[model samples]
Target chain A: MIFGLVFWLLVIYFVARGFSSRRRRGYRWLQRELPSWEQKNIINAEQGDAILSLYKLKRIEPRRKMDMVKVLTLIGAIFVGVGVIFFVASNWQRIPAPIKTILIMSVTIFTLYMGYLFSYQKEGFVYLGKSLLLLASLFWGGTIALIGQIYNIPTSQNWFIMLLWAFPIVPIAIFFDNAYVHILASALFLIWNFLYTVNNSVANYYYPIIIFLFMLPTARKLLISRRINIIGLLVASLYCCFYKYEWLSLLVSVGLLIYYLIQREEFVYLYASSLSFIFWTITFFTVRKIHPNFYFFIPIEIILYLTYKDKIRENLIMCLVGLLVWLNLSIYSFCLAFGYKFNVINFIVMQSLAGMVIYIIGIISKNREYVFSEIYKVFGYLVTFVCTYLLSFQAMIELRAQVGLNNVYLAVCSFLIGIMALLVTNEARKGYFENKAVRLELFALASALLVNLILLASPSVLTCTLAANAVLVIFAIINIFLGVELKMSSIFTAGTVIFALFIITRYIDVGWKLKEKSLFFIVGGLIISSLGIFLEKQRRKVIERMKQNE
Target chain B: MNKKIIFFFIAVLWVIVVAAMIISKQSILRKGKAVLLETLPVDPRDLLRGDYVILRYKISTLDLDQVKSEKPYYKTGEVIYVRLEPRDKFWEATAVEVKRSADSGIYIRGKVGYCYRKELGVIYGIESYFVPEGEGREIERNIRREKSSVNVEAVVDSKGNALIKKVYIDKNS
Candidate 1:
């Protein structure tokens, strides 16, 4: 009931907000622009006058009024449909089987008839008709359930029945051009497919084949949105993952990538496809234990770079990052596959070598305007930071015993990397590099190195962990102060998130002694509250200073 | 006008399909022979089907000796016909066959749930008996307290498919 109330409230709020905002904006635009258009001779004086008079004559346009009516009718239809379902469920056993069947059939026919009648009679009632049709579809599903119960059909048969019911909706959705119906049909088919696969305990190789043969054609004919297609494909991919169908998942991911690449203008699809492709590739590797090959990504990156040559700078940076990740993974895979005794020292050395090479390339690329060198520079800095962290971690682990030559070597390498990063930042500030992001990257790298040094100096694991966390907390505080000084909201938000992470780690690390836990929480709460107040005050001061300067 | 007529025809067809499903089931129940099987109770709730107890019977698990099938092996999900004979208070499996026998006395169709060595687990479609909301727990409690078993009155058609008629919970308790 609470959930229903909340859902209805949200619906009402959004509808009211949408209509009011649209109307207000429409009127405001006409008022502000009509006179200017007339003066600019974009519109004639007569046309302008006619437009203004037409706007004033109608309080709301006939079309908009009809939209309002349709919205209300749709809402009413949904409520009635739900009421009918509840009425049937509550009084199900009381009714005779024949009577129950007849009643459900009657209701289904009545709603479907009314839906058609409303749709045929007037354009304004189309939404009302669509709502009724949706309800009718739901009633059809309910009828299947009713029959299943009446016949005491096996639970496994339910999916097949649903599949049959959903089959008709595809035609309905396409013929009517109703997105809601399309969504409903897609969801039903996916659900039936999922249940059918699970209940039968069968491998779902047929799912993709069915989708490609039937669903894809229907989706194309219906002109269903990419969102629905993406969802269906993702669900299919999930099933493939469950069955360990690596090739199928790879195909789906590659298909999605190609689909998005063809429409590379839409960033949403690009990002979504990238994420899904990465996820599928990682999962496929983990499941199949395939030897990682950087060569596979090279052709794809080259294709992307060539295809998106107009946006060379951004695409090049993306390709570079992809290549770097590929290189790292390939190295790891090679070490594993060759059965090399891969120690931390070797890992750090490889990473540092790659980082330095990339940093040099970035420094050279900085002179060119073909791409943003900041991406490569930041990537290099990140690689160095990771290598330093690993070395320091290993050194800390070995600190309990006598420090070996390997540990000493790791520490020296980390210190030298940190110095290199600092020198690079100094060079960047001297106008050799124009990217401010590179400076920020170096600052972060310097902080990481400082923390790593602290960890290396600590004797015990507990002390090292605690000291590292404390340094992070201190870094967050420094970041917060710096953000306030510069009045940068992103920096402030980052600091706040890092501070929260520190608190969470502390909570997890500390033992669950009641007194200690309580004290810790209480102290933490007080400190956070105090810091919040102080930040708010600083924010106000910063705003005042900006206002004065303006 | 043409669209409305088509929609009306489709709607009528849908109604007929639904009606036919129920009518066919009801016809079988009316024409089939009735038998009572003692039920072993287990409570479960379905979201759409309301509260219910999963009913298990003595015939659910068939011993290799009781099964009179010519087939050497039975895999899961394969349907087998079990011929029941009235014994004591309820019917027990007299014979099991892969196909329906022509001289059927009282047969119940079941799917092979799993096979473990010599024992084969069978599941009848009429395993769940739905009750009103909040009544499943009460029925479970009643069955537990009475120490008397619930007997399900079922009707089996010529096809060996059984439909549950009613559940009598401890009439003598």
Candidate 2:
């Protein structure tokens, strides 16, 4: 406890000190260097103008019309081929390290030269050259490092340290005006970090920073380029979110957002900035371990409130961003709640509650989109519930320690849970006349009943209740399909309730099997088959009815 | 005002972010310092919460003659300097070093030391410890856990070369 206390104090002190006005030594150095850099930029601007004039003169001179397709193909082939070679080399032990190094270096030099030559041309060939260079670097560097690990020279740590240095070649390529190299570098850097993250090593943090820096030059160029800045920014934003460096990443994004705001000189920044602030405020509280649950509503509420304001289109963007953040937070919460084996109940309850709250908030706030947003969560909960029900009886029998003395009660409860799931599904569907959600619920309801019915009719079944449940389950499944074809969410929901009866029937049956029930099996099977055929006919009728209306 | 200026600012911001990202990547330090208000005397016990001596930092450089006869100054508060090192291959500090001292002081129980940086002058501490004390071991456990903060006291000198005087436990922030 003393150790924990002391540790936090040190953190508070250093962080506080860092935020203080005492200007970090590095910051002081940066301040001193900025003036000189400013002067250099002025020089470069003048020089660049002269170069542009020369470039115009050169443009009038004879020049080759580059065959971009051939160049791009060659570059693509090199990259893909490198992947194959690396894949092979990773598995093979006999390849000499020096030979592999030479092979990689040869391709590296060629690709770099090609990239430099194409830098000022159309950007298509530039991407190819850059990608090839990055791939070559990975293969050469990774192979040598792996071989060193095998030989145990300079230690594994040294090899890792070396790779860290080698990995920056992608960004260097980008810095030199080859965006393709940047892309290649970013992808490799992302993959490398992902591998380490899966290994749960602390060193994985470097991956995000690498990709962030790697893509900066490219992203900067995009702000001026007429083509697809949004897509580029979105990708970078995703990378930032993925790597858990959203703070600074978001700050850099805001700078871009500010530029966009100024260009349009619109109030969109108000919406964007508001959404950013509210989302982060909630994130901030949650991260600090203070009143996490209360703050979760802040973003949703602000978004809904903003909808009633003027500039509906800007508000819509804010609403969408807010909704996305809420969902993101919910997913994180769900993982935290249900990620552990012991938290199964907590997971289900929390997700259900979260979904229901989102619905309630949407209704109260009069934000239709917020209500519509919860379809996936509702479907997720119901599908998972029904699947669990399908396996419940067997699960109980297999994991006896969990079932205990309340086996019959547990079985009945599983059935009830399935029924409760239908209630959630109905509420979800009723909230949105969304065809997608209704159809999905139909799939879940039908699949669950079908599985239950199979468990009953199979000859080697252990219990009579299982067999009886199976019959009811089959009927329920047919009914659901019919409802789905009719596009009636309510009717489909009712079918799910009927499946719940299979659970209830199991509870009332005192004996494990209904005595002398062999005849019932044959009759039940025949009836089920006939009912399925009838439902198929009904499905055809519904489709025909819909077509006639159209 | 113009596209060029906008582009230039963007470049500058990117570079700034890159630099910040690099420096921020410096892993947080897990060790903290605290002062012992009173001297604590302890016995060696194998099962005293996993074999560590509970340390109270006495005056850093004790006048062995002054406190030699009285209560062994066991309960008198001493300043303890906690040494933490960067995690190497074995998750142990490969090159162990003192972080920062709270202050420089002369006394058996209040003196602290072991301050060194790769490129900085050492700062001495007000208190130091004779350990197998439980506190030192707890500090070890903390550094391993990568705890967000550790407690260190500010020992200000006349020259204002303030170092972390000692490592101490504080219940409240």
Candidate 3:
């Protein structure tokens, strides 16, 4: 029964992959290139024919780049897996118990086969394959569940069951040499730790050490990037915070950053310690809202010293962004839990300053041509636009009565952001930046500094709202002009979409009653869709213009 | 060749695991003593493993006075044994203790859930019973109508481990 189940599952999986995507990749590559090569006399017609024959006879092709087929396959896998899980969960009486168990086993085998095919198959989609392996891990858990269902074994939310699911995949991740699979294994192991501890404090500091051992092998393998390894270290450091050793989690986080600054590639020192911190913080948040210990800033100070000494700009910037996100959530949760007043206006002001900090960092990263330069710049623009748009609401009159920024969290956040601006200025003085970008960076810094004062003074909601709407219009216009200058239509379209959303949001706010807001959303979605069409046309125009110039 | 060997090994390993799981569960059911427990069931649909009734037994919560523990409060996940005495066709908790009595004939083991000052909640492995989809709501409705109607027959091994064998709802309730 098990063998048959496994066989049918494999057949179903391959059939799904085969039917959805045509394996005409090589043919397409040949078609695109062969004619051009022939016209250029790069290859004779006879040679071309020979290559075509080779492709046809061997059923082999050049590897594909990113395409719709892989995406479709990924999406299809998710849908099918979820559908099967839901079906299994239903415990349908129509399907006999044995059949239900068999079906689950089949899916488990099928997903694992797909994962292996993707990750380890000769000429496999390694990136997609690792993701598939993670999905397979999930299916394996489902397989356990179905078995539990079949035999009336109690398995729901059993922490031991999660450990069972996690352990088997750890070897797979290491053997397959896939970072994403390692991440999945790490996350699952961490989740198990949380779930188990919630059951009882049976696990000790050794829990994090176990987690570090998982990473130790991956780090030694040296297949993944140094940056990912660093991130992994940071993630592992999450453990200490989880077990109420908040100071330890924070120290480990800084310690990892410092360790990476000093350590050589693929060599690790604090393997046991890294595991302790990440598991604690992530697991802590999973079980209960964690208060950021006062020790948070101590790490920032250490990071500043390291930044000054090492010029670790890329990791530092990414680390700052990660900390910003983590700290933002933790502080908000702290405020809510402690009954501190949460003012939306203050939040908006804080976000804008945060945006300025991100934008300035983006500018600096772009000047240096860092690996994730575009991403930082894009995120910077996104956060700035989102905050600005939020602030543009005309209904600020109702929000005028508010707690004046008594938020120590906001102050601490600003201080962290101010450090970023200072770093940018220090770099600019060293002549490490271009004039245009530096100017923009300085403007963002000044704006951020000016707002901190306004935020501190508790400006009236009406004045802030008017200023925000004007700034929004100005920023949108600037984005459109920048797009034209840079010959990038995505930004131009974004500018158009933002301006439209600004108008539409206010109309939605005033004209639409609470009941009719869904209509507003529908219309807003259509507008964005139309703007996308506009973007495609404008993008083509720019391309054509560049081609003509060439 | 190495990859092929690993694949075959993993495949065989899973088969063994599934087969082993079945054999172990079957062994417990075949050799264990069957005891009936009066219970109530609540329903929740598991995303991956269909709709099921969560059985909260009358014995799930024990008063501090009833249990003979060294301390007043028991920590979560601490193991405890409940000695059962058959009362009116269903076994009821007669005594609770931290140490299992080797001399006892009928008892069940459970882990301590978040124990409050006045009450200690325990979780036996046999808490959830998977029911057919769309049938769980009806079962829940029946349970609501007759609170004392639900009774489950469970199999207990020599080691004090228990598995829920069957659930019975009183027809005249």
Candidate 4:
């Protein structure tokens, strides 16, 4: 209970942090960019001054102080309410059932009354008041658990508990316009969806009911990114409904991708990258035997091609997206031609290959095109690192997988990678190689290809494993250097952690004398401590450099 | 939608639900007949509410050869009526009917679990007994003891609804 309470408190911290003014950020950005705009002759001096004055007149800075107040009060009230709950739980069995019921009811009612008094009757404590109101519902859930425990109520029907937990508090969350509370409600609703889907064979028109009744209306009323996350939960529900049909699920995802791409062209990379995960899962883990039909890919590929053909040459993102559709179709064709079933090593190699290609394309289009480069690069990093990290294991390298597969995506992606590499080489001829970022991107791409080639050749398990580990170590170093160059702490952390794990994994399985092992542990501990200190100093230097540049 | 009114409604609604659940269960305990039956216990833990014992009653499985089901086989989740009559100190299943016939007295409704191979498995919904944390294993061990027996005392309503009132572990010490 305390852990759950603490977890929610942290969530509330992040939620409360969002109260810091985005409008202020917009002004700050304008303030910073005005001089650059002036230098570029995009806006005249008078217009810039007018814009500055307009922001100044609106008076946004004072809200920062209010955000602090809101966070503190919300945190404090939640602590008190959850404290009451913990107190009740500790003494639950000691008290008689009737007294326990009274105690639970009284506490719940009192919190509601106090919350009402503070929110409606008192002023300047609305944050605390609403928090208490939210906790009032939370207390009711505890009451349910307690009473159910006392009465021996069956929870084998997890759907019942999910329903009771989810449905009650959503209206309160919506009414209060509390995004954190609304998010929690949405999470519970998704849990209900999973439990219900698992318990009942039929999905039975359920999510559409919630989606129509509560989800969309709340999204409209609140109109925030948090509300948008509820839509993501709808995807999970739909996934649950169509879990048995991976083919139908993939088609649904592809349809969603096309719809979103057409509707919001700017967010094409994000929608594509996120929805691409469904392809990865369906392609990798599917047991359902799919017979390849050449005609199946024709309409789908033609539709995608006709839709994106005009944009493909002009837009780098669309260029890759066009290839993505081709990749899928080619997988089907390859399945037909060679009768190649999917393997674990093949999937990893292919995903890594494609990821590097996407990343190289992102680097190529960095400033030349209007692109959301971070999202593209993030998808690349996620697939590449995760795949490469898995390939490091000896078991994965040696495991001969004979599974049901209807796709071989690697063959087509290699062709795309070759063309993209040619484009990079062409750019290099014009002295684009001088850019360190492009050099790093090329290095990563080469490393991915080398790893894929090594895995493709049937070598001894030790050779593949060692080579994979070596490549991972080199990439880790590259990541560290890139992090240092770009001043990104997360990438730096990932690099150091991966290297540490690499060292740990090497020492883990090898047969060593106990004394030698102890010696290594002590020596390694000292080295890690020194490295941490060095990295901290370097990180500080990077931060200072960034600030100086700013 | 005044804030205070909503708060009042929410608070009142919670209290009413709690009260209603308690009142209904209390009515069943008070008015319904108490039937004792031998059962086996299996201990399992729930994440939130802690440990519980699943009671499998002797009456849970019905032999089709003895008192046949009305239907050839019942599908999962299909409601089936199980008529109980006193046999020694415990109640035994007399017949399982798709619908409660006129002679189906002192019966409880169960959802069909598996009804095939001349055997029918019925789930009475009174199978779960939520114990205090770490205590279910003790009761389960007692139920497994050869010298003694574990029995479930249940209160069955007129409309065939049943709730386990208590799990009596009569382990001879």
Candidate 5:
């Protein structure tokens, strides 16, 4: 109860803070910049007057007032729906089976009717009606569960109940053109499919195909949201994963890719296609083990690049990353197929060389219109840093074994890679990369290389591993601090994940002891909380400084 | 509007589907022959389905010695029919058939679970009997204390599909 209270309080606080911050920021921008914009001739006097009038008009818009009302209604509807569910569940045993079923069915049908009436008849209450419709769908599911309980049906019949609930909602969603209902129906359908597969212990190869066909008519009629398509693709992908059917993966990938190609304007299609392609490739490599077909991906990549060259400016970097992964896998397979022994150092060297070649090509081409070249350049620098780190470890291992030519060769390669990385960092700092964040990352890489070199010279493997772990922990802390200063959510998330990894690894290594583990957890929690407080303070200062600069 | 018509049609169809399911099950209960199978009490509670007992019957695991089939090998997941004959107070499997026979007798259909050495595991569908919430625990305690037996009264159709009618504890209704 206390946890729930605290959670709600935190949610309320954050929501209030968000609204206040947005209002303050808007007010500040207007106060600080409106007169300047007028003076600078960005806006004529008449345009400025129009803008101010429009802004005022927006504040009292009836549509906005209606939106607030709709939100409140939706919340109230959800609460009432939940209350109904609980009421039914609690009084289930006391109520006769026939009356219970009738009550639930009547309630569901009534909600649906009311929703339809409001949506069709009442203006400015469309959202409220839609929310009611969604509630009706939810209640339909509740009705199914209640019936199941009343009839004493086995849990295995859950799939059938879900199917019955989902089929009706699909038509409702399509007719209403409600995205929420579409999403809910899609989710229920997927769950039904999953439950059916589990209970039957059968692959159900035609399940995805049937679902896709069922959705097509509705999707065409409603112009269904991209979310539904993505969900469908996810369901298909999940089925492929469970069934380990290469043909299904191929079918899904090819189907999505064709659909995306046809609907080239929609980024969601592209996203789904790219995800399915990756999954298909992974499945091909691991499940099928058909290494000879790896070469086929080269022509496919070339075809994709050439066909989409005009639009490459938008998604080239992502496509190139996919290609790079495919190429690396192909290379690995080729080496294995031959009599060559698998060597991590050799693979890294080859991959880094490929990265450099791509980078050099990008530079020589001077494709200023596209940012693809710039991405290639950054990829080159990243690959060089990673390869150098690996080389340093290899050189250290070789040196420890004996003072040999291989050790000297590895050390020389590491030094060259490090020099190349530094030069790339310099080039990036010279404004070749556009993003200022790359400079910080490049400097970190340089320092990491130096630290790696020093740590490699240590005598024992344990010492090397420990030093690496400590460096990782320190880097994670630095990332968190930098994220706070820069206001980069991705960097902050990475730092949090790395810190979690460190804790997990330490726990695994130490195993479990009651008192000791508890103490460890307490100390860790305190450290993290303190760090968060410090970061929060720093964030405020940074934001203030940024505002002042602006 | 066309959409409303379609929506109403779908709603009616959905109701028909659900109604058909209940009616079909009810018909099976009303028309099918009833038989009692002795049950061995196992787990007393299901996490999601409230109070239930995992009941094992004598026919759940069959011995190869009782095999009346000409085929030497039976694959898993293949449907097999077991002809039941009254043995003492409860029915026991007398013969196994890979295909349904013209001779109408008490039979139960099950899927082959596994064939190992001399024992074949079968899954009959009527494996669980759910009681009211908290009643399962009391039934389990009584069975353990008095060394009592539980029998499931199931109605089996001509197609060998069986549904649990009721459960009798210590020969009580």
Candidate 6:
């Protein structure tokens, strides 16, 4: 199963590469280089021939400037790969001293040969140099992994001590960008450290955070964007939040937000703002749980509201709502567990009150869009809560009457609620939902109804069965809507969320179920994959046909 | 200035060589001085703290007339070294050499680094037996498992010249 996953990932990567190449005029430019088509081949084969010709071109063409840079890169890659293989084979504890000597001597000799090639006779010196550097990086990284494995039962103190020496190497790799040495080194360091951190009380594991921080300046300068840096920072922030560095996470998010806002880098802006929202949301939940009377969540909510007030435009509303829904669900779950019962009246009343307050504030500020929009959302939530309460009551009464409910009925009820919530959300989104905040509120209402229906229906059927069904249906619907609306990030985020959900929920289960229904599921998955490929093929065909006609 | 750039590269390379040497000096120096004992197995847990391979003499396998300490047992501070000879294919201490009456007895420098036992018979921290650079990794793995042990057989001449002859794992049950 694991190997299969790796294989499929490779396939996906290759296919993506192929498509990107085509988009970059790879076929058009390279096809002429190929020999003339044989008469035995076909009467008409344009699209397939283009792809094949492009592949042939990439394989055969001398990329002439395999110069100093390219040679160095290849050398580096080879070094890293060989280093890992040798380190694994040596198995430090099992080899005789003579053998160890011979192995090290051999590696040293290889390194020298590569070095000589780079310095003197190599045609593509840059490529050779890169390969050497890559090889070195891999060895450097593989050594760390080997060391960690060797001292598998190292003390926490010893692990930290080793980390002090090891963690700094990754940043150095980045500083040079000579190779991915830093990345490999840091990855090796992180793997063991990650294992140790789990079920341990070592507070504020700083290596990952430091690594992300170190990558930021280089990522900005060399990569031409803050995307990778932001992702790293976000992950670090999550780790910090998870491990109880709440205040630090908040401060870091704010600092990033201000830094990005000043620079006007969109990626940094989104990352910092979203992360800050998360930190505050988490803070609100945790604080409310710890001290119910503190009412700190209220102020945090206000801060979030103000911070995102202008930024959370119509398109970002659903995203914002999604965040809120998640936060509230966590809060609700925690609060209810601690003897805090939530009646429908109190919950609806609180939501309405919050919505009304926002609405009134918007009115007073003369943000007419906010006033009209937020009022509509406040009403939407009010109606949703009422309907949810009635339906749940009806479900209870039906259960009492029938003494049983089938999976089909559960599916029906869930689908109906989902559709209804979606329709109402769409209607509210038209004009009255001028404010992103209000649209977010309406989306939250719909999300809440959908979530409740899902939860209520799930238990009656098999455990993950309902979740899988609802997720696919909702995911498809949302994807189509988002695509039609041309909300790029939202569509991508939804797709990513769907992929993550499927991987997490069904990956292992599917793997196990594969053996039993091996033929069916495998065939189905393959068919779906092929269909996607076929669509791409068809699109290419249509484009080619259009060009010929033109 | 051109000379200086050349000098700088040379200096960096020199520094790297020096660092590598400093890290690996002890193991290199101890190479070929002693033979690994193939008859006895070394514990896997004891291979980590630098290139010294520590082994227990497998005294249970030997039928000895008596086991004796070379120095005073109750002494507070004593330096003792034992000279061992091959007896019936087993290495046994033939003579106990004591430096003073003031110290502990029976100090061995093989497995742990320079181990010295107090009057209470508790031996702590010995550093003995060095293996060359690459072999350290193998010894480390051997110490982790109890199936077989890599041991070195040393040839000693009549004049007490100890030279390593061969290395083998004595897994004879």
- Number of the predicted model whose TM-score against the real structure is largest: 1
Which lDDT tens digits does candidate 1 get at residues A1-550? Answer: 1232232234334433544467668877787777778789999978877887665422232233456776776677667766665554443677787788778877887877777777677676778888887777767666666666656565555576667667666655655555666777777777777777777655455555555555654564344544566666677666654565666666665665565556544333443444344445444445644377443564456445553553333333334444444554454455566554334444444455456556655654665543546445545644553444344343434543343224433444565566566656666567765555444444554555555555445546665555455556655775566565556665565567556656554544453345677787787678667767775676567656655665
The TM-score, computed over Cα atoms with residue i paired to residue i, of candidate 3 is: 0.58
lDDT of candidate 4 over A22-141, digit per residue (tens): 544666777777877877999888887788766442222322345777777677766765665555434347778889888878987897787678777998878777787777766766
Where does model 5 exceed 4 Å of error? Answer: A1-68, A79-99, A121-128, A150-152, A205-207, A214-225, A290-370, A377-550, B40-58, B63-78, B94-97, B112-119, B136-149, B171-173
Worst 10 residues of 4 chain A by lDDT: A310-319
Candidate 5 residue-wise lDDT at A519: 80
Q: Taking the tens digit of each residue's C-alpha lDDT, what string does model 2 give over A1-550?
A: 1232232234324433533334345444544454455477844545544553442211122346987775775567565655644443333435663464445445544544454445434465655544554444444444443333222222213324244424545444445654444444444444444444432223244443543344542555443221232333334334443344446444534544454445433333344444454335334434432223444465446445544433233344344334434443444444445442222322222333333333333332332443333333333333334333434454333333342222222243355456546655655666653555444444544444344334323424355235434545654675577565766654565566666555443443432365657755665557556656665676567656656765
| Candidate no. 5 TM-score | 0.65
Query: What is the full ranking by TM-score, best candidate first?
Result: 1, 5, 4, 3, 6, 2
Summarize candidate 6's per-residue lDDT along B92-125 as a digit string, tens digits.
Answer: 5543344322333222321111223421221112
Local error of candidate 6 at A455, Å? 14
Output candidate 5 Cα RMSD. 9.7
Chain A accuracy of model 3 expressed as TM-score = 0.50
User: Which one wins by TM-score: 1 or 2?
Assistant: 1
Candidate achieving higher TM-score, 2 or 3: 3
TM-score of chain B of 5: 0.87
CA error at residue A259 for candidate 1, angstroms: 4.9
Which regions of candidate 2 are displaced past 4 Å? Answer: A1-107, A118-167, A172-180, A195-207, A213-531, A539-550, B1-173
* TM-scores of the models, in the order given: 0.66, 0.37, 0.58, 0.62, 0.65, 0.43
Encode model 6's per-residue lDDT on A1-550: one tens digit a residue: 1232232234334433443455447544544444334234532356546666444333244346646656556655665666555555345557754454445434643553464356345564645554564464344334333332332212322344345334434433453354344444444455445544442434344543554456444454444224444554455455553555555556556656555555443333544555454554455444444432233344345435644553433213323332433434454554456545433322332332333333333333333443234333323333333333322332333332233333333433444455554544554555545755434434444444454544453444343244334434454345434433443443434444444444433444445456567775776677557655664564455445545655
User: What is the C-alpha lDDT profile of model 3 across A56-104, one tens digit per residue?
Assistant: 4232345678777666756765666567667667777887777767777
Each candidate's DockQ: 0.31, 0.02, 0.49, 0.39, 0.30, 0.04
Across all models, the iRMS values in order are 2.7, 18.6, 2.6, 2.7, 3.4, 10.6
- Candidate 3 lDDT score relative to the true structure: 0.62
| lDDT of each residue in B31-131, candidate 3, tens digit only | 88899987878888765577788888988988877755556878888888888878888888877778888785677888888689869888888888888
